[model samples]
Target: MNKAKILVVEDDRAIRNLITTTLETQDYQYHTAAKGSEALLEAVSFQPDVMLLDLGLPDMDGVSIIEKVRSWSALPIIVVSARSEDRDKIDALDAGADDYLTKPFSVDELLARLRVALRRARQDAGPAGSPEAVFTNGELTIDYAAGCTYLAGSEIHLTPIEYKLLCLLAKNVGKVLTHNYILRQVWGSALPGDTPSLRVFMATLRKKIEPVPAQPKYIQTHVGVGYRMLRIPEGGPAAPLGE
Candidate 1:
C-alpha cells in the first residue's frame, strides 16, 4: 500500500474497530490482530510502520510479545491499553514500546502523537542525529544512540520513563520544565492535572540520579516551578548520584 501501514493488536472488538476506523479515515493502510500469535505473524508478514499493542492477551503476556518483537525490530510501538497502574505502563515501555496511551483517548490527540512518533523515529534512526545524541557532564555520560548511560565507567539501570525524563531535561538543560509540561511530555496527554503520581515518580528518579538523595545536585528543584538539570561548576566536585 502507498500509505504507511499501521498494525493494531488489540483483543477488544470495540477498541480495535475504533482504531481501524480512525486509521481508515486518515487514509492509512492498516492491519489488525486480536491475539499475540496473530500479531507476531502480522509483524513478520505485514511489515507495519508502527504498532499499537494492548497489554492483555489471552495466550501471551504483552511484555513477552514486546520482548520477542524487539529482538529484531525497533519499530515505533505505541502501547494502547486500559491498564493504568504505574508498573504496568513501565513494564511495557521498558520492554521496548516507544509510547503509551491509556484507554478513552481522544482520536485527534492520538493522530497528532502518531504523526510525531513516526517523524521522531525516522529522525532518530537517520544517518546522523541533527544535534548528536550524547549528553555529557564531565564524568557522567548518557549516550542515547547506544541505548546506554554511565557514571564514570560503569552503567546504571533506569526504568524507561526515568531515562526518557532524563533525556528530556538534559536536552533542555537550564530551562525549568514545569510539572504539567513534564507530565504531558513524558507521561501522556491524558494525565490528570493534579499530579501527585508524577511527583512520586520524580522522587524515585531523583533518588536514582541525585548526588545525595537528601540534597540533589544535577537535577535541581525549582520550588513550585519544576526541575532543571544543572552542571556542577568547575573546580567543585559533586558526589556521585545515588551516593
Candidate 2:
C-alpha cells in the first residue's frame, strides 16, 4: 500500500472530496484544508510528503502558497486546477510547483503524477552526503565524476551544451523542468532564441540516448510548459509523451 502523506488544499468541496476519495482508495494518508491559511498551517503541522493544491483558493492564490512553502520546504506541490491555459501552467510551474494537472483529469493520470512526485521526493531524501556520483535511468548512465554519459554500455559523445542539458534533466528525473528553469540552469539566463536552442540540443541529446527518438522512452515534453525525464521500467511500455 502507498504510504505517502498528502495535503489537499481546495475550496471546492466536491473536487476536494473526489481527490480525498481517490487517495483513500490508494491508502494514502492525507489532510484537507478549505482555505489557503489553513492549508499553510496544515502544511507545517502535518508535514505531508506531497500537496495537491488548487490554484483558485478562496483565501489566496495557490501560487502564493507555493512561494511561501518553498521558502522553508522542498515539499512536492502539484497544482490541480481548472485553469488549462498555457500561461496558467507556466505561472504555477515557475512559482515552484512540481507538476500541474488541469481539472477534469483522469484518476489514472493523477496517480501517475503522484507516483512521479513521490519518486523524486524519495530521491531528494537520500542520505546526506556528497551528492550522488552517478545517475542511471534504464539504458542511460551518467557518470558525473568522469563527466561522461553512456547509453547501452557505449559512451555517447555529446556537445558541451548537450551534456549540460542532459545532466540537468537527468538530475531532475520525474520532475517537470520548466522552459525558463531549463534556460536559466543551462544557459545561465534567458536570452533571445534560447528556447529554440534548447529544443535543438534536447533533440540531439535524445537521438543519442533514446532507442526510438520518435517514441521517446526517457524525455516527456509538456508542450508549452517544459520537459520531464521519465524513469521507464525495463521492457515495459513507456508512458505517453506531451503530458
In order of appearance, the predictions have TM-scores of 0.56, 0.95
| Tens-digit lDDT track of model 2 for 1-243 | 877899999999999999999999999999999999999999999999999999998879999999999999999999999999988999899999999888899989998889888978888778893458988888889999999999979999999998998889888888888899999998889787788888988899889888989978889888888999988766765554245
* Model 1 lDDT tens row, 1-243: 337889999999998999999999999999999999999999999999889899998889888999999999888787888887756766676576766677878888677557645655665666765656777765568998987778767788788988888888776543345666677789775266546776777788877776577877778765554566654445675322110
lDDT of 1: 0.75
lDDT of each: 0.75, 0.89
Over 4 Å off, model 1: 128-243
Best by lDDT: 2
Question: Least lDDT summed over 10 consecutive residues: which range in candidate 2?
Answer: 234-243
Highest TM-score: give the candidate number.
2
Worst 10 residues of 1 by lDDT: 234-243
Off by over 4 Å in 2: none
